[model samples]
Target: MSDPTSPIGWGIQLAKLWTSSGQTFPVRVKDIALEVTKARFPEPVGCVIPHGISGIDGMLSKRQKKKDWCISYDETVTVPGRINFTIAHELGHFLLHRQQRDTFQCGQLQMLEYDSPESRRIEAQANTFASYLLMPRNDFDAQVDGHELSFELLGHCAERYETSLTATALKWLEFTTEAAMLVVADHDEFICWTYCSQAARRIGAYKPPGEMLPAGVLEEIRSKALDARKFRRVAPGVWHPSEEAIESVIVSDQFEQMIFLVRFPFALSVDHEEEPESDAFSDLAEKIQGLR
Candidate 1:
């Protein structure tokens, strides 16, 4: 493995810590930070404060007087899931990047912004640390064992991990065998981000971050209201404007944010998708065309 402080490697350290102490799942991250910081470092984290941090989700710095390390966050972020993610993110900065600099301030989009490779890499490291610390790989896989994929299963996993639906879904996609995708958008119907599973990428499910919402959605969806369709099978181009893509998509309306969980038929589909011009799937096509 690489260095223990690397994004993937840090997970190994966290896993070791979790297992050595009775293998607690959905680990109590903040408490662990307080315990581990003092145990593992010369200058321990003095505080993890959920207080006013004007423009950022989380910030890491050193305090005055004794000048110990401290974490600051926007106390206004009400959702427990978001708050937890933010703090864990700062802990990531503390564990991974503190040696590189004295202070680290991060906005919600820092990791996802992708403005520069170096900046994105560090931010992504923080996110990975947070994800692995909260949801261990073995525990997550055990939860999904023998169960087929669905939006409801994702909801249950999100509840178990105490993270947001989108965060947990993204984490699930990171390790799931099932094909999946998550698209998040703001209240103005703007695309915040999009994720394609390793399986889905074969058929080219990738989309740029700022693409507009496509035309086939209902008015309520366009308005970004809350109305989720559990699992609706749709033809290609409903979400993506491609002819060779079809998906079983789940739309969850988290008020302004819309999450679409698109699952494809098989990982092997892309390998077999290159077929002759003849309609080998004509019967299937006729059934689908009838719906329109």
Candidate 2:
């Protein structure tokens, strides 16, 4: 059981209300933000509005004189998933961290923080709260049950939950039985962040955020106009020294980043044909070996 005073607990409690009322997918967080705050506190959320802010994705501000709260999100972000998540993130602050500070100004990175131990406690808590509030466990589980995990399948879950692909992928990682990792890299092919499932971690199939993506299929996809959606079987040393992995790629023009879904099999097949290592791949392998 989740702590009733915790962020996840509060989110679950609200989600239950929507579920019990026979409400459908994509929980209307904006409506609940205003209503819940008003019902619970005197200095409730006065408004949930959009602002033309440049750098800030969302801001939760308490009016100094009026003593009321307002949740404002960037209006220029056209993606419904990003906007909705930002709104929910602000709502998380309103519910969980309103008393911690007078205001919270969040950017893109803060919104993506989920369960990182090194992330700021309050920000991660708010993100967790927003994720649960937007996509509850029972509903999310039902959507992905019995399906082979892939970027295409996750895209459907994103659409169903009205969440960004990254958010949806992270949610799946939290509960998936497969050994998989979601890697976000910049247009330059430098890794920005990574989230691995427990199974992936157990097998040491993980990479840190700052490392450059090794020269391989993922790099080739970024450099050329290849099918970004197709999953390629990458050779050993590209991702792991002894184990080969399947790599799926997607380029997000909106965020100007590449998303890679890497899945590792439980055991390496001995009979699988091996590709001859190219000069670049060999050089990369040497570099990676030196680092290890």
Q: All candidates' lDDT scores?
A: 0.64, 0.73
Residues 1-292 of candidate 1 have per-residue lDDT tens digits of 2347465567657766877788555566677677888887878788888768665778888775666788878878655477677777788888888878888887755544436667666776777777777777788888888976766786787777777666777777776655567666555666666666666655667555677766655443546533343445565676654533333334434354556666666435456354332211111121111100
Report the error of model 2 at residue 42, Å.
Answer: 2.2
Give the winner by lDDT.
2
lDDT of 2 by residue, 1-292 (tens): 2326776787788889778888887888788888877887889888989889886889999997887999998888766587788888788888787877888888754543323433356766667777778788898888889876788888888887788877788777877767788777788778876767666666677777678888775557747774555778888888777678888888878677778898887543333244332211112222221100
- TM-score for each predicted model, relative to the true structure: 0.78, 0.82
Runs off by more than 4 Å, candidate 2: 1-3, 64-66, 109-119, 218-224, 268-292
- What are the root-mean-square deviations of the candidates from the true structure over C-alphas? 9.4, 8.9
Task: Name the candidate that leads on TM-score.
Answer: 2
In angstroms, the error of model 2 at 221 is 2.2
Output the lDDT of residue 37, model 1: 82
In model 1, state the lDDT of residue 150.
66
